[model samples]
Target: MEGVPGSSSEHECDSNSLHSEESKLRLKDAIKHLEQLLLENDLVAPESSGTISHEAMQIGQDLYKSTVEILGSKMFVETEELIMAESDDEEGQFEEIQDDDDSEQYMLPEKDKSMEYIPLDYKIKVVNMAKEHPKWTLKTLHKQGCSRLKSMKHLYRWEEDIKHGGTIIDKYSIINSWTYDRFVEARVNYQQVTTRNLQEWALSAASQFENFPFKASKPWVIKFKKQNRIKQRKITKYVTEKETATLEEILAAADIFRKQTQVLIPNFHKDFIINTDQTGCQYQSTFNRTLSTQRAKAVFVQHKSSNKISHSYTAQYAMTMSGKLLPLVFICLQEATGAFGSKVKKAVDEFVKIYQNVKVTSSKSGKLTTYLYTQFLKEVLSPYVKHEKFLLLIDSWGGQTNPALYDDIFQDDNNVGTCTIKVIPPKCTPLCQPCDVYFYRQVKNLIKRLQNCSFLIEQKREIASREDCIKIHAIVHHQLSAPIFENMLRYAWFASKLTDEREVFMNVNEVCFPLDILKKSCDCKNVTFIRCAHCRANYCFACFYDKYHPSTCTVPSTSTDE
Candidate 1:
């Protein structure tokens, strides 16, 4: 008996080696045909020397390695089939329901499970084993490598199904496999593919099949990720809020908006069509990067105060199609009751006189509310209406879109004509809204640089008070309003795809601090202290401090007073 067992082990080893050789031969032939197909389809890119690129070679090697690994692994058997069937088999069985109210459900398609499939060769082997050993029980068959057969009844059903010419492959299996391939392709291209993205892609690809039942459920995602060796990782690249829609969708909406507004250009002159929006400004914006020793272990830069980065004020800007920034900027400072306290109001009132172009007010959130928006239209926009009719392009913010906000223009006895409002599509602001496309970034750049200069030049450590922030806002707006920046303002519109005419211009940083300009002496004939953002002049520290610049205010105990 011992000698017989030894002979059987040797025979099994020989059989396994034969199977391995056959699999290797088949894989080699398949790879050869795949290479030929790739060449015919022009899938592999060649270098100038007419040789395959290194990238292409690397890709092919990776594919070959993965195929070899798969072929080396033993075929999986569904050992749990009996348990699964038994659990669900009892018709009126009471099952415990688990609460899942807090969990979010996704409708992504399920991954193709190998267990759901039985290879034709394996089926034939199992059927032959049963017929040759007719007295062998189901447990005996399972111990002999027919582990996936749930019961004798299942074996009989499989025989009948195969006798009737039914296929071993499940319906829609190929399509489901293709959907997974598409996901892998998308992931390789650096797309931040979400569960929704997978679901949508699967549904679109499977739409041709009737009643395809893949929902891309949570379980499917788990299995698909595990099988593909994918891991969830944080995105290192810059991303924006525009992911609500695809690039094509955003571009299409922008094109529609451009066409719609272009038709009205002839009716309203360039100066009469205005684009306006509000942006939040930090009191003391600081640079997130700075100079340090090349091999330093760590780097640190000091900020004025925590509130400088945490608190913000709103500044609204209006620019016409003629490339002119409206003369005034409407500013709303954060305060309770949407109005400044006694002390702060007095300081703001006095500051506005010095800087006439800034109309300062207060709001609870420092955001442009409907009430504050109406005031902006009246105090800032109404004064600039030179034509009988004008067009306004704004975002879809609730405050800006209020119908009552435009009633004054239509109900005017002064024959001001009708004011038409065109809203930029939702989530399309980054591509179609002029202010968001280019203007706000430039403004923020200016704010951070100015704050850094104050720290480096004057050595001020305290946070920029509300008054200093307002002053900085005025200076930045005043500088941007210059005739020199006209083309830059127009470029905002062009960049947003609202205008066809392209205007080449430098942003605030490049224009203000050119190497040649920075080399020159100040107007006071001394070393340049800082470029006066308000007057656009170079002044020495002494001259600027005594005459041009205001003394830094004392740091307040809190951001705002009651």
Candidate 2:
């Protein structure tokens, strides 16, 4: 009786174990199928998500339930071990697949690969080979010596594409998405966009990131523009400043200014009536056009001081209705503490001794200030006026518009009597300001030409320092003060509608650099390089730069005196 009970119980236990193994096998097959689905759809969740998809969750639940049923008594320890082992294997495979997918994401597309572009001549040759031996396979071509022949299928495709007159189709898309985003933002903000700008931006983006398929080439620019539907249009107009009011308002203000100054003009002498303005002058001026070969698409000039072009200083000029420039020019240089250092002050003192007409000062912002304006009045205008009752025309700059600011300078000095100040109407400088209409443009053009001549003749690349600016201004002031420039100054008053008479005048270039002067000899008896505007004499580079003429022209009988 005992042997029968033991035998029956053992039979029941064997049946249970067999059933558990079958269920485990089914669960594993289901898991395999789910893995296949996930792989095909690229649905492998990253470990950082800390969760899985619904299908994966179902698989986990079924797996856990089955393990619990199979090993009921020891389910805790063994089930944990089993699930860990299975997950370890699956995670290893999944991670490998993920790594492969990441690398594929970075790989350049087929059309962007440089190898895809074949020469037209080579394509024609390949087509000719095909025509000669229609039955020969690409393998046969390789055997018969076709250079760069790798894929037979690709060779056949190329011949067909060539027959259809299709191009080789190698092109590029934007590799750095950040660059594209930034480019669109810039365009939306009305920034000027160019192919070179795009190339530079792409290169910069590539430097900061990894695996960016950047191509800073013309072809890439062409393709990118086409892909984005961008077109190059000629810029019809550029807006320098926002309009303050409607057209009628500007005209009315200008008219009011003309009428207000009409009476005072009769009382003041042409030589006594003065217009003063301050303009920003760059340390280094660059030329827009240069001599270049006809075949060249781009022209470049060598400039070692190119980096300093952005820095600027202020220059104040005064002109009279009789077309005469004042003898002195006030220059405000950029300094850190609103003053110059001891060494620079000494140099400036020395410089002023040579060019006695130039007045040099400093401000932290390099702009005209109340104190500097007073200094200019005391140092420059007071000495030259000589007890003249004059009318002063100036723009409505905050520092100059205040009438009380001029009290101390003229009150203490008898030479400069009580003067009248006339402010140009707001927002009408371009229409009613004398300096804006004529003088500033002429001065700037002359400065640019002189700078260019200095570079081309002497191979000088130094930026105009504070002393250099003072010298240049002195030379320019002396040149414009000539009797020849009288008509030019008169034209400025006429252009501003301050005077009814229109005067005919030639510009600085026409007056200074005549063709006749080009063939003359310099003061040093060398071939003429430039006409000295200050001395009205031709000078070679050696005489001008080496001897420091005009700037240091203090001798009695030489080209130094006016």
Candidate 3:
């Protein structure tokens, strides 16, 4: 045995070959047993038995071919040799082999697969699916076999982009052209595209395009805050297109007239330009917000009775472009009788004593009639026109724009050769009339404040009498000083587009003499003065009665020592 050591190795090889032949024989016998069991159980139909046998035979042939190819490979032979060597080294050792479960405990876990890039086809599928089932969640899609999009956040962003008219196809994809065009068309047409509409469109697209890879869900749709509704403003007077057009035409004409007047009357002073307008003054206090408990619902406000005859007065005023204010004309509703008339007369006399140009008139209705307007022009306006040429601006009131009134003013013997009358555009008094623009608002505000104070005073005492109303109004009128009037006049002219020289309108603080300046003592020493009723000049009372009382007196004349 020691002489032939190689003979043992040859015997061992023969033994291994014999073991492999026995294992192959056993495998063939097991396969034959499986076929016989299937035939006995009749699991396959008799008609398909031949087909099953043929399939089995074909599978076996494929298996044999793969086995032959693997065994003939160089790598397989090397692997077999390595395994044999390892087995021979362990043959002498007594080792405890592990079971399948014990071996799994020691084995390393399989690594997680990396996130894969989604194809354009898959993205389109997702968008289409989202359109169909807008209410489905990402988890729901995953459960239904849509695993292309991994995260809910990513899915929601994609869904939102599509809803906002984003194209599903990639920018560089060949099929992007059609998708982009469709997206643009949808965006143009769907002005207020809603989540539901987007979802429906996506689902519809998915149906059209076969092989869509993703599913739609509710969790993928973004929510938005609802827009707040705005309240509309209420308009009292509805201005029509025709009225606006007419206003524009009138404005153009007014501009032309202004330029022409400037050229024609080159030396016309701003002081010679005048605007007059009428406003209503109410006896009652205007409603205004007052401090009260936050929760109080019903607040009692004191106001006079709404009697047109006794509660309202028509106030007409004139303002020069140089900011000089003329005396106010109050047209009372009552006739010249009773306590109302007496109080008005007393107030007028007092006002005339203080301001020479003031006048008070009465009418059945508290409005300026043509006759009253003519009286206002004669008494209040005409006295202030010291220039040879003057401009009178008035609104388009029927009484104010009367042809007879215009003729009277121009034909007046006292007027400076030229008296140009310009009627403001209809319904444009607030913007074009200086009195309406500058004076009336301040007058109303002051009047209201005074009225409110009087009302508060009356609350603790007796009701306000007509005399009290008249007194309050007089106080308010007197408080409108020269400087205030001047500022208002400048603002009015500026607003009306009448004057551009701001400096000319400035410095309105110059001393303004009241109409009753002549009523005071004459400048002469040691002489009693009397004012002439016509020329408004102070004279010795005896001399004026003896000389100027019967004739028009031009200058003050003192009595000479007898």
Candidate 4:
């Protein structure tokens, strides 16, 4: 009232009322502006789009950045139960983890009885039955008198069940697929009993169901919900230390491997290796058809856990190359070997090719072949090693070793310089090998790719039938034979890999590779990196003369065309 110079008590009331009206008009303008923003955003409009509000966009950007900060590096999200495992005591870990998941009831009356749970031998019986019939049903599984899931309390004790016709390859694949911690996860993570998804009616070859007991034979998905939801994430903080190769190395390797896998097409490697080795690609006048497509005879899966790695060897001779650094040949081999009625001699040749050795006192040809992979170490890896000094990693298997493989690779009549073959400390391979850290990446992608094919088939058929095997094999060959996947494998293995795998071995982990270029490194840290030739996967030993690579992998690709 004092500020209104011309106003007395009556006039002051009118002036104050006008001021309040002006304030109400400003508030109405503000509300109109907000409503306009909501309309632009289309949050309330059915036919509107491309109208994100500035405030809303900012919020979304913040969420995306947070996700990248936490989960961006990995292709797969770690199930939360694995993260929460620290809170559980050892004794409580073994309690039934999935009692609520399966609707099926345990029928065995003596399941928990001590006497019936004795571990027994069953390999011969199991092998014979599988070899004889190629597939099994619940009736056949029951004939073996193997302990049902009700009979055993621990998963490890089921090894005997695998021996008899009680368990089949699918179960073995499932068991071997997970790390020990994952086995504990299988036991603890869900409401349902974790069974092999392959044998269940989930996959494509359902009508041809092998009706096998749940066993770990190959890798399969373990689907469980943490707090009951499919947790989507982008950023992951993995525990990092210099114990072994980090998961980054493995993923990068797989990325390289996935890209470089044109080896599935075939190679001049047989002829090149023949020249390199001064011998034919055959032993005893037998030409090996196994390597027709570029592939490893056996994958050295150095299963590292708690500062130790158990070198679990799986053969993939009949398998085709899906990748080099991260393993892809395993699943393919399991499928192909099961199909086409694969043979044992071909399998053994694959074993012999991986490990090299001199003859020993054996009546069987006076020599038994062993995997002393010193040759690849000597010829290909030697010149690229660090400081003229390098580390050789191997498992604690009692097979012929490659100590000599590393030490004196270059032979001379005059004088041989010193060399070193430093095997990584036992059980430390997972920490040391780059492959372990990154396998799940491309491995899952590859599985997802294969799963896509399986799902596309007619509903009348699924996996493990004579027809499904052929169809899946054809699909696998087509996907792998594609140039994109093959180039990734080649780029990752030959290009992305480091001269020394050690993290401290010249800051190797920091040496990252994009899909475009991989800057290679060697000891003295000399670098030599390669790029794609027109971004195509096919490689020719003779650049100009030969139009196509070796005709072996290119064998008309009837499957791809089909």
Per-residue lDDT over 1-562 for candidate 2, one digit per residue giving the tens place of the 0 to 100 score: 2533122332332335544776567657656655543443345542336666877677766765554444443222221122111111121111111132343243334543223245433554555455446555544555454544434335555554443323312112223343465466356335676665565454433322223233455655675678677788898665446433544566578779888998899998888899999987777765545778999987777666653466678999999998888889999988889899999999999989988878999998788888898888888787767666788998977888887776556643454446788999766776678887668878877777667774354655553777778877877787777665787788778767688665334458656675556668876677776665444667776676546666554323343211
Q: What overall lDDT, based on C-alpha atoms, would model 4 receive against the true structure? A: 0.28
List the candidates ranked by TM-score, beginning with the highest: 1, 2, 3, 4
Q: Candidate 3: TM-score?
A: 0.42
Q: Which runs in model 2 stand beyond 4 Å of their true positions? A: 1-243, 294-299, 412-417, 454-458, 523-525, 532-536, 545-548, 551-562
Candidate achieving the largest lDDT: 2
Local error of candidate 1 at residue 498 (angstroms): 1.6
lDDT of 3 at 351: 46
Number of backbone collisions per candidate: 5, 1, 9, 57
Q: Which ten residues in a row have the lowest lDDT in candidate 4?
A: 274-283
Model 2 TM-score relative to the real fold:
0.54
Distance (Å) between predicted and true CA of 23, model 3? Answer: 83
Compared with the true structure, all predictions reach lDDT values of: 0.61, 0.63, 0.47, 0.28
Tell me how candidate 3 scores on lDDT.
Answer: 0.47
By summed lDDT, which 10 consecutive residues of candidate 1 come out lowest?
A: 79-88
* TM-score quality measure for candidate 1: 0.54
TM-score of each: 0.54, 0.54, 0.42, 0.25
